[model samples]
Target: MYAFKKSLSMGFDQAVEHVVEELKKEGFGVLTDIDVAATMKAKLNVEGRPYRILGACNPPLAHRGLGLDPDLGILMPCNVVVREEEDGSIAVVFMNVATVTGLSSAEGMKELGEDAAAKLQKVHDAL
Candidate 1:
């Protein structure tokens, strides 16, 4: 799969909070948050799941990647998602960093992706 996912037993909000703390412990910070359900409702008038996309970044790794290729910003922050399932449980997911970052031609990006993927794996495991 292109992502690492875990079924969480906690409520949606609590799962989001737990994910943030776990990511912090792994030296990552959430740089952005996209509320998908809200966006879909406002833009398309469609009902959707309780979904949030979190842009998580490890600054040192990002800096290294950017230094190799300025255009790497497209792949800078990794993505973590918290979405409510039909069963009312939350699913915490992380994009497979190496897979997504593979689109970059940055010199050191492969290693950076590996390192970033490792951290994200830890975050997923913590859930």
Candidate 2:
């Protein structure tokens, strides 16, 4: 299994909305939204199931992580996902903050990642 997976059962749109709300509660904001399903359909003329990628960021946490290690920005914001399963269930998933930010060597960044991971886990659990 990949290091960055957490799943919650919900409708696709509802899952996305819930994640956005939960992330906001954790002081993070959705900065980017890419509708994989729509994009693939439009760009590649390929039909696929529903999927989306959300880029979330918390400014204070980002600042803290960057302060610890400049290069940590490469893994900043973390990615959250929403996809429809074959069984007609929606699964919302997010990057494991600890795993993704662990790529950095800065201890402070690691700590920040751990904190963020806790918040994200809480959000997932709430879902």
Please name the candidate that would achieve the greatest TM-score relative to the true structure.
Answer: 1
Candidate 2: minimum summed lDDT over ten consecutive residues — where? 1-10
What is the C-alpha lDDT profile of model 1 across 8-126, one tens digit per residue? 99888899999999999998999999999999999999999899999998888888878877888876588899999999999988899888778887677788789889989988877
TM-score of each: 0.93, 0.90
lDDT of 2 by residue, 8-102 (tens): 66677888898899889888899899999999999999999899999999888888888888888778667888888898888777788887877
How far in Å is the alpha carbon of 87 misplaced in model 2? 0.5
Using lDDT, give the best candidate's number. Answer: 1
What TM-score should be assigned to candidate 2? 0.90
Alpha-carbon shift of residue 43 in model 1 (angstroms):
1.7
